[model samples]
Target: MLWETSPNSTCLHAQREAFIADVNRIQADAELANARAQLRLPSSRSLVASTKEGKFVAMTSPARLAVSVLVISGCRRHEPAPPLIRPVQTTVIRYGTAGEPVSLSGLVQAQNQTSLAFRIGGRLIDRRVSVGDTVSPGQLVARIESQDAKNTLSSAEADLASAQATLVQARSNEARYRSLLSTDVIPREKYEDAQRQLAAAQSRVAAAMASVRTARDNVGYTDLHSNVAGAVTAKGAEPGEVVQAGQMVLQVAQKGGKDAVFNVPATLMRQSPKPPPVSVALADDPTITAMGHVREVSPQADPATGTYVVKVGLDNPPDTMRLGSTVIGSVTLSPQPVASIPGTALIQIDGKPAVWVVDPATSAVVAQPVNVVRYDSASVIISSGLKNGDVIVTAGVHALRPGQQVKLSPPAT
Candidate 1:
């Protein structure tokens, strides 16, 4: 607003015209920018103009100074350049293949599974093993009442004694009979009857001995015994319960060699080739990753879930990865060639896999979508939407836009 009004008319008129032209140029640039912004288009504010035959006219020679001062001092204002658009140097891959790692999840299971049962039936009088009880091979676990077996043993002893007494009497009578037969004191028919009675008594004794042996076996069967070394995992019958023959009274499990089973899509499981290598981590703590190999892959899928049973056997299994412990398995499908790149380069475009490719000419960034087949430990496999050598944004997606300037950074070692 403060200015000196000069009385020299021609010079003042020339100066006013030059100032007006400068103002027009600034207005034009602002209008152009507003229109481009409305269309969401990008353009640089740098102007390049050349005039070969310049007209002889009074011009604002200090146009830059005038523009800067007016704008900063609020006398005149100029539209600004878009905020410094920096390119994020990202690593990327064109569509290609590489061997990649995969992992699957599973839970620990007892490998040697068995249900402990009784062989013969009787009242369970005593039970030494309960849930969580440990036992060795041939260890007695429980016992049943054997009153009938004891009675049978006593009866068999009486039969044997009676047979022995009858045998002695028969021998004495035979001696007398032999002497009598030489004279006529005793008849042959009487001696023959006595011999037949003694033979019958001997047969009865043999039958009783067999019965005693059977009774002894029955008595032995009344005591429940363990046949393997393991811990009792379950107990269905109590001491007072009368379990029948071959009933599951206890469940024992061996101490080591556990496995994990998980259901996977049928397509993922391959039976023709050897099963894929896999790694596992406990769900409670994923950092504790345990290496494992595929133990089994069921040929069929579960009808309800449409998944095949995939078993993984662990090595150096963590203490936390115990039986019934939840775990996640990364089942490695057979490795195929894939483009390996750092994970920082990945971005999402259109709600799908995407990355920013560096332009060869402009050195600007342009978004490109990609299909991530899988994530290896150090790199990623892209199934599609990339090239083998195309430069991609690795570190900065938020700082990027189309046609943005870039600075190349060294790849990570």
Candidate 2:
């Protein structure tokens, strides 16, 4: 029953069966590789296949080959990242045609502050006014113990009474001696002696009168009075404290004008003798503002702070600008052509001031030495370091070195 099979047909069937087996093997290998990939395992670089002619050939799938290359390369050490290029804010230098304005902290004060004190020294018995109490002209502000003063007055009055009695007796004796002399009942020498006694008594009476007046004044001085209408700003003495003559008992701020007081540096005080008007405003609330002019400056600097006291008289200040209130004062110097820069841009080099200047062509920063005329809170006046067109890095100056490369921030929108 075995029919003779054709040789060509046998060969063809064998080839077809082998090809189908190879295709199935390839599919299985692909599945295994996909599963390994899902499990995050390494995949083989190539697969082996048997051709119909019974020869083995190497085959690499495009997806698996790409993944294998990536994995191998990733395992290798990475090169270091590029150096960081920092960005910085910058400003173009410009010279001020007008003088720069300077601002300082100040305090509101009374333009005419007068210290109320006793003309005579005594123990303070009663203080009629406390701090911040309103007072009027000739108002009694305080009083000292007047017992001693009254005793002194009583003694002066007794001396005056005695002198007056002696004067009356002397006048009577002189008149009686004159009448006796006219009637030849007494000698001329006696009348002259009576007249001389009367003169001496009159002189004693005059001196006693002066003593009484002085005592009266001392008694009146025991009660301290305010010469001007104002408010009591301070108290230097309390009840039961012994105070000296001319010692401050109460500080009264007169009702007329107000002043903004500031402590200015000696360098600033050496400028123009007469400065321009100052703008004063409340420290917490700037909306409450006023204008003022320099009314007085201390002839000598303070020994503690080495600063001069400057008083600026305000023009019609608001009621809320009371004495002792904190305020801000601003003064503009006379116009001069000077260059100034932000304080942040200024850096120190070898104990001298310098700045980071940007090169327009290379965008590199270089430390250029600068001569600073003065330094303020927000700015520095340049005497000879920077020019009008020089560009300087305003921020992050401390982080940079000479010849460092930097990127400029875009100008503010």
Candidate 3:
């Protein structure tokens, strides 16, 4: 005898309530702080506990009354969502009309990429960020050996003070000499010399001020910093390494980094599709999504490539992408008529682009493969497909092959 399967008469939601309560009690007994906890809905399903692994540690999933029991490290917890009853299938279909816009391929670049270096040559005494280190604007990068710079600054300050003192003394001497000359107690030449000394002292003071400026500038150079917020793509010199003025020390990619290039066909350009927005899937991490923008479009097209070069700029490039990562992305830009059809309507015949055309008169879809010029959001631009007023199977197109009979009504309506 064969047993027929049917939906359970009982709702799992009511039964699971008691099970959930029991799980909660166990969690409380474990003394795990109820950090970010939630009960799974009846329709949803989940184990009592789950574990997540990180760079340094791992947390095991807790067991539920229905499933397996587990031990976990007491640390942090995730903001849990309502549990899912069963695994759900997920798919993403991106469709767009062809458009034209600029494209750039690059790592996440700072708006203003800058390299911090010393104003004067010195040994690097400290470095705050290494390659792949993220830094904020005005954050320190490194400091140069500044003992010499400080000494020079100190000496200039002392000279300035001494010159001022000399100026005062010279003025006093001049005044006394003038009085003597007027009274005929001293020769006129001596009075002139005293006046000259006063003038010299003033010049020395001005010179000292210039020296101070130089010294102050030198002191500032001893400390290097990033001018903009971004990750350190490269390092110039290590700590204790000597660097000279104007020497390149580091390379940084500005946020919204490098450009993505695309070579599109000239015929497609005529359609004038909107430029494709860009995103990146890094070689190191294909799962993480990144945002980017089209930055450039070359008017000229290369016949050999049968396309024009378009560039895109990426935002928030991961460390892997920060140092110039290779990535591939789509540029959805085309000019054509839009259509919304079931995914089943698409068919390829004779290794050429084609689609099935459904005729309302006969209630039949005929294979009429046409050139798939480009894709629009939720539709496709067919330059040589079916004409206006032509309809085709939107659903279950895959089930029917070429020259196969199709029924008007199916059981799974």
Candidate 4:
């Protein structure tokens, strides 16, 4: 260092040293900035940086944010989630003190139904009435051919006339014979013969008279008459059709009384109390209702339908309720204690019949299995698994779950 050196070499050495010192100073500054960042605590709004693929991503929350940086340098964001609240409808179930009424579909029919037929065999030459035609008592409804009948009557009349003439001649001979016997002008045997002849002729006349009356009656049998005032319900024979004796020709429904005929189950028939009052209503017009009583119940059940035939007699039924009209009959039975709920409230949970019961305090629902006693058109009778004063979800049952919170809507007025 004491040795004298060239000016150019000295200048080059100084420049190299200065460059080394500047590199050290930059290194030290980078270290100091990293240390300061590590010492500071993270705040709520602090930004966290993560490296994914080859790019950096910044997120607000470390626990909730999932950052996935694209290899091509892009960002994707997701919005916050909202709370879940379901709206539903509920109903308060109560036990029915008045038992459920049984309703059955039936047909309105005349109480007196008769089948009209001919008494004698003949060709049906005329039919005066058709189905639904009104007829009165002693009204001629139909007639058969009268040619043969008339001929028979004529022959009987001629026989009767001949017998009458013979009888008169015989009586005259008997009188003459009796006068001769009294005067001893005729033998006793001859008088007895004359008396026998008169007796035989009188018997012949009596027999002929009976034949004539029978012939007259036979002729009358060719005509068909209605014995009651009614409407024809059916026609079995047509004009010019030959029908046998006692063959049904028409069906007439007599006027005066109406009956509601219903086919009821055997259980209902057995359980029905004595003198149960039945109420009947027209299927089309329910407002036209009539009070009636049980008229007749079939002792046997129908094999095909397994139901008993029941006839209910209407008291003073209106004329508007025509024959063969559809009707509905309702009968009230003895009161029974049973829990009843709407059919809509029924559901299936865990492969069992169930309903949703709501907790009043928590407004949560739980699926409760129930013993179904009977199912009706709009309601159901529960035998067990349910009690009175229990709140049940009637509507929106399919969208509910156990322990799920719900907001109930106001009940319908």
Model 4 ranges with Cα > 4 A deviation: 1-97, 185-187, 336-413
TM-score of each candidate structure, all chains considered together: 0.47, 0.68, 0.43, 0.58
Model 1 residue runs over 4 Å out of place are: 1-105, 152-204, 263-266, 294-311, 335-413
What C-alpha lDDT, on a 0 to 100 scale, does residue 228 get in candidate 2?
A: 87
lDDT value, candidate 1, whole model: 0.70
| Per-residue C-alpha lDDT of model 4 across residues 1-413, encoded as one tens digit per residue | 31123234554455445445544654554444444446654423334453454322333343322221121112112355764557888777677778568889999999999999988889999999999999999999999998888898899999999999999999999999889999999899998998899999999999999989988998999989999999999999999899999888999999789999999887667657788999999999999999999999898899999999999999999877889999999987566677778899899877888998888899888899998766788888886887777788888888888888788887432
In model 1, the worst 10-residue window by lDDT is: 50-59
- Look at candidate 1 and tell me the lDDT of residue 127: 86
Candidate models: Cα lDDT each:
0.70, 0.83, 0.60, 0.81
* Candidate order (lDDT): 2, 4, 1, 3
lDDT tens digits, residue span 25-98, model 3: 65553333223232322211222344363111113334442242211111113556863222111112223344
**Which regions of candidate 3 deviate over 4 angstroms?**
1-108, 180-193, 251-293, 296-325, 332-413
Residue pairs with backbone atoms closer than 3 Å in model 4 (clashes): none
lDDT, candidate 3, equals 0.60
For model 3, how big is the CA root-mean-square deviation? 31.8
lDDT of 3 at 198: 99
Question: How does model 1 score by TM-score?
Answer: 0.47
